[model samples]
Target: MKLSVVDTERCIGCQSCMFACSRLMGKAGLSRTCIRVRSAGGMERGFVVIVCRACEDPPCAKVCPSGALKAKKGKGVRVDLTKCIGCGNCQDACTIGAIFWDDEADKPMICIHCGYCIKYCPHGVLELAKLEAGHAKR
Candidate 1:
């Protein structure tokens, strides 16, 4: 599926997306979220939403020594925690800074592309698009 593209221009740096993601997993705060919204050189420049783009060829998956990362139909790369080794290779592989670290578990926090974060974006910065048939390459 299409990644919920973020329009940097529209971002208010509210970090609602980050809160929403963590809450989806029954967590209480931003520390556990796969998505991150932080100020870019102070809030006046606005915020940046760090999340997966559902790459056609995900480097994170290729670098995973344990095969913890898997590409899925209509979604994107989802991490298999059991297989993950907490190597942080995916974190380094991601150019967008989408992969987050759960310091408590010492593992990368990955996005499942569920669109839950979109609902919490007050500035209309994120939107999900459908993946066309045969669009996935990896």
Candidate 2:
């Protein structure tokens, strides 16, 4: 399954999804969240939900010099922490800025498409979708 933002217009910028994601990772703040909700300048513009679109061929994996970021068939990349060199290549390669940095661990936080954060999105802005025949619904 892949996580997608279906309705950005519905977002109230409550940040409940971000909090839930962080908590699931055994943390207590935004530092560990794979998802982010940021204001689109002001209240009139709603907000933007930044997250992985789960590319079939993720650029982040391609730039990882240590091979720590391995591309999944259709769900993006999985991290092998033991092989990660903290070079920041994966983070820099993510065009959408979905890859988050763990300042303390000096590692990147890639979404696993676990759908844990979806449960907390009060606005129904996020969805866990099943890809069909190499295509995903945005």
Candidate 3:
């Protein structure tokens, strides 16, 4: 399953999803979250929820010189932390800026599509969808 922003219009910019993601990492702040929600301009303009779309052929994984980021079929990339060299190549390769940095560890934080954050969204803005067989988005 992959996390989807089901209804961005329903989002109130409460950032519950972000908090939930961080909590999963046993942290008390936003620094550890793989997901981010920010205002497009201001609260009046709505917000943007940014997370990995689970690319079929993720550019981030392709650019990893250390083989830390491995592409997962029909999902996304998985990070082998021990192999990561803190090169920031994955962040540069992601066009959507979904890749988040852990400044303390100097490593990339990526979503595993665990759907833990979806339950915390008060507006039902997020969902975990099953990938259709043989379906691909370029």
Best by TM-score: 2
RMSD of each: 2.6, 1.1, 1.6
lDDT of 1: 0.81
lDDT of 1 by residue, 1-138 (tens): 555764877997778888898999889987779878788888888776777777777888989999999977667788899999998998998887888899998998888888898898887888888775655422
lDDT of 2 by residue, 1-138 (tens): 788889999998889999999999999988899988888898688988899888877899999999899987657689999999999998889998999989999999989998999898887999988876766556
Rank candidates by TM-score, best first: 2, 3, 1
lDDT of each structure? 0.81, 0.88, 0.89
Question: What ordering of candidates by lDDT runs from best to worst?
Answer: 3, 2, 1
Two-way lDDT contest, 1 vs 3, winner = 3
**Model 3, which residues run further than 4 Å from truth?**
134-138
Q: What is the lDDT of candidate 3?
A: 0.89
Instruction: Count steric clashes of candidate 3.
Output: 0
